[model samples]
Target chain A: MHDIGVRETIRFLGLTFNIETLKMTWLAMGIVILIACLATRNLKVVPQGWQNFVEMIILWLHDQIDAMMGRRGRMLAPFIVGLFMFLLASNLIGLVPLMASPTNDLNTTLGLALLVVVMVHCLGLYFKGGHYIAHFFQPTPVFVVINMIEEIAKPITLAFRLFGNILAGEILIIVLLKLMPIWMPIPSVCWLAFSIFISCVQAVIFTMLSMAYLANAVKEDHAE
Target chain B: MIVLIEINATILAQILNFLILVVLLRAVAYKPVARLLQQRSDKIKGDLDKAEADRKAAEQTLEQYKVQLADAHKKAQDIVDKANVTARQEHDAAVAETRKEIERMKATAQAEIENERNRAFDEMKSQIVSLSLAAAGKVVMKNIDTKENDKLVNDFISKLDKNMFADLR
Candidate 1:
């Protein structure tokens, strides 16, 4: 597990980059794109194979998001669906030999969580105008500090929740590899199975939480 | 752990990566798949609606046939009833006409019998009067003439016909 905390980084246009994480992200993106293209290739009224499978995922996300946000949620369906697909891909990619999850890195998860938080704020403002801002100081002005901290904690928790789980799973696998060297196969398999389940669960959790936040932002508040 | 969670420019690149991914995936994946699902949902809904409409149409046609069948049944009954009424009227008229013809024939036969009986009575009276006149003439040839005898016979025959007709009445 010596290389657990070590990173493969590079310089491109004078900016430092995490090459390992970026490359994994690109791979996940490519997989997402390829799956989408293959599913959409035939474009039949009666769907079969990949078309049916992909449509099921897309529509499931559509329904889940639409339920949270109503018709307005339809606009966010593509992003939410794409995010889920990407996260699922990123999470599962770590299972491959010589591969790591992009989500296992802090940068990728933090970036995603920040994006969700920022989107929530932007959508809140767009939908509720001044009320979105005023809601922070709700019930009394004294609550603003708590509310602000809560808002800040949202992205942090979101990022760490995903990053922590995936990184721990990867670390444990490495530890098992280091500790159990020859007879590591059984522990590896067991952990791999657990990690796969955890991967799916984490992806769902992140997507659902993001959807809730977005819905909370865009939905109209009832006037008393 | 600090190194593992360190912040870097890679976050910016990753953000850019996710954004590009979202855009590209939306363009290539979500939109087309969503549209296909929508189309399939629409097709299913349309087929269901068409089936419902067809069922309703079939029910409507069945109702119409039922009404038409009822009308035909009523019409056939009316024809039978009308035929019965016409047949009764024709039968009654035929009976009345037959009764009238029978009555007329009886009256004609009575008249003809009365005429023949009157003529026979007149002839008998004439023969009786002639015989009596002859006897009287025989007696009177010694005493009267033939002209008196014929007049006597004719007057007697007329009287006999009038007497016989009165008695019969």
Candidate 2:
């Protein structure tokens, strides 16, 4: 099996760099950006071809954001859509020959989770003010410790859930390939299809969780 | 065949890449497409409003035309009715005037015929007196006195009753 971590680092100017994940991440970013540019270029009032496809994807993402985040979804739609696109591209890249999925690395998923957690807290403070921190001690003071622990667990679980699933899928595919190397391609093919399904699901889950976090953070606190 | 788990600089690089992608995609794609959609919807709304206004104006004009046509029809009917009444009155007056003229002409003709018959009766009476006087003169012959005879005849005629002439006729 390939390394579970982003193991390939290139030393440059006395500094170490994790080159494999970085390169793959950059490749994913480039492909997404290129498609975005092509889709937006020469946009007609009447859309056709690539524009139609891109618009459909954007409209679906918008609907997801609206459903999950309610009235406040409009402000965050672009970021959420970008997150989904990036995750989807990164996850699917592993299906191609000689490419590793960047999301398989703990560092990458953790970084994304940290970003979400920080944004959530910041938005909570902005929208709810003191009530944001006061939610932990609701009903009685005894629940404060539990609430704090739950809050800390949020990022860890978010990161590990996505990382574990994608990494396991890739590992399973590798093992299946090795087990049936010649003449019998059914097992490997089936595993590949399953891996693809997992990748798509993980990307959707990450995006949905992120939106949910945002919605929870920014919502108005109604005292009961 | 081995796997390593570590935290390193790749996380920061990935974060940076993700942020850049978000900004780039937002600039090149999301904003423009959204603006185009809004503009198209606004244009469609304006066109619909204009079409509605045009339809309303056409309906108003048609209504005015209908009213005018109705008025013209009523006016024409009134004129025909007035002409018929005037013609009937004129015919009635002409007939009454012709009847009055015929009555007046008949009265004038009857008066003229009565005057002519009276004049003819007077002429016949004068002729009879002259002829009777001549016959009396011839019967008396050379011995007869004309003046005396004439006086006698005049006296006799004067004393005679007019009713005796009616018996003679």
Candidate 3:
């Protein structure tokens, strides 16, 4: 934990980075990729064993994306699915002792939030063009400032929401682990299960919200 | 005493970090994983398509079998109908043959009866002729001479008349 808190640690050839989060993130990413590759290696029309299960998950994600984004969801399926799997894996990796979730750090969450915001704006501009900017000035000119403030608040809210939830869960588990020695591991176990559930939920929620924002931005002519 | 300094991440630093992570993830993780998923989906779709094709072919084969069965049934019905017609024609021919045989027997029997009646009539005619001649001869012999012949003839005529009258009565 002390080693994790200490920032700007460099070891080889002056490549200074956050040690714990970066390492876990890489490891999680590698695991997801490896699993995907291994599952799809001998692709058959009638999937057997692990490939069949993995295909079900992908198809399920496809349905969720379609539900959230409608026809355009198919286009965004790969990106959102990839993001969900990556985040879920990273979050679950934190459950292991001595491993920190990169998402628990503000930097990672902020980065992801900003990426979503930028993509949202880009899609809005691409789809709606000049009309997209006009959405902020709706009802009255005064509302434009409010809309702008809300847009600015989005990334801050997104980052803190994820970071705070994960960090708090981790801290609570740590505390519980220390407070009760005999039955102490029970709470940790429960917390671990809960954290896994919460991580999956958060990933889905985050992707769903991002898709909604994009969908809202991309609506062409809302005259009424 | 070591003082803990809080280092704020600059926008440039954050952006650089973000780009690096994105690039790394894209290269090492996201692309490969997504590609694998795409391949799997393609495989599944291929399998589904094959199954659908097989189903359609099976349906077509079933239809063919049904059509063939129907044709076979129709042919069987036609054969049965032909057999019934042949049986009916043969029955009618046999009845006509029986009727012709009865008509020939009736005609033959009528001809035999007519011939028997003609022969009986002929025999009766001959007998009557013979009897008449004998009566004439007896009258002539009993008279013997010239005057008595006339008288005998008159008597004979009178007697014949009486007899005729009696027969008539």
Candidate 4:
């Protein structure tokens, strides 16, 4: 079998950019968004049946956001909640027999990490103004280099952390399934349970970290 | 050298695959899901607001009812007290009229008894005088001598004078 790693997936088109992963990511994003929209199109206040269940999930996410982010967290509630739901859907879709998790690839995680990094910087700068950049010097001038390196490393580490976890977990599950045919049912059930739990946890952690980073930036800006 | 090139190509491929996934997810999943969630949140806030307003109104209405109930009870009690007072006054007036009537009857009966008693005393005195005059005329007729009759009349007059004088004092 092919190594099936991220390196094998990249290809350049002229001087512009890569194309395949973008298309797949977009497709996956589109399907789930469409489904979510249709599900909540007609919202009744006292939700009945399916609508009630969907609304409950949304409310639950809001509560979690409130708990983690506080009152200011309410504003970011929709974004963070939407991110988790979408990620969970994407991850679970990968578990389908013929499909693969988009997150199992480094490129997908990198894009998500890039988005988070951009959001964090934008928020931090907005709150701190020009002084936000000055935080790099921190305790001493020599720390400036260390801080800069850490800043640069942040996206790489975050992206790889998620990618590695998802890829390794998926691989282990697959290998176990193949090895124990007699105990196939057990592994399948365990994999499903574990994967779903991990997927949700990862989504929460990612969103929480982004919020924390932004909050720190804003706090620093106000302090100065 | 060939292995290094292949490794680079593989990395590139994986990156492309991931990019496609993210783009697809953003367009198809995130947009619609976010919109739906926002709508649901707004709806919940609205319901909560409505419930609060309704509760406030209900409390106000309850207060109004309590006031009205108290007022009604006061009015009922006032009517009862007024009726009792009116009945007491009527009873007192009836008793006073009965007493006045009884007093008037007693006064009239007393006046009638006093007039009858005076008439009886006057009749007894007249009867006694007539009997005494008759007896004196008889005695005069029987005596046959004028001087004797005169002496006897003088003695009777003296005796009457002494008795009358004593009675007058």
Which candidate has the highest DockQ of all?
Answer: 1
> Which segments of candidate 1 are over 4 A away from where they belong?
B77-169
Q: Which model is ahead, 2 or 3, in terms of lDDT?
A: 2
lDDT at A189, model 2: 87
**DockQ numbers for every candidate?**
0.39, 0.36, 0.07, 0.08
TM-score, candidate 3, chain B alone: 0.42
- TM-score of chain B taken alone, every candidate: 0.54, 0.54, 0.42, 0.45
Q: For candidate 2, what's the RMSD?
A: 6.9
True contacts kept of 4: 0.08
- The CAPRI classification for model 3 reads as incorrect
The digit string of per-residue lDDT tens for model 3 on A112-210 reads 788778988998888778778887898788999899999999888877887777777777766777777875487778877898888888877776777
Candidate 4 Cα errors over 4 Å, as ranges: A1-24, A47-76, A177-185, A219-223, B1-169
Give model 1's docking category.
Answer: acceptable
Candidate 2 Cα deviation (angstroms), residue B13? 1.0
Per-candidate TM equals 0.74, 0.74, 0.62, 0.58
Off by over 4 Å in 3: A3-5, A11-16, A219-224, B1-169
Poorest 10 consecutive residues of model 4 chain A by lDDT? A1-10
For model 2, residues B1-169, the per-residue Cα lDDT tens digits are 1245677777777777787888987888888877877777898899999999999999999999999999999999999999999999999999999999999999999898878767766765786677667757764774577787777676666555364456445
Q: Is candidate 1 or candidate 4 better by lDDT?
A: 1
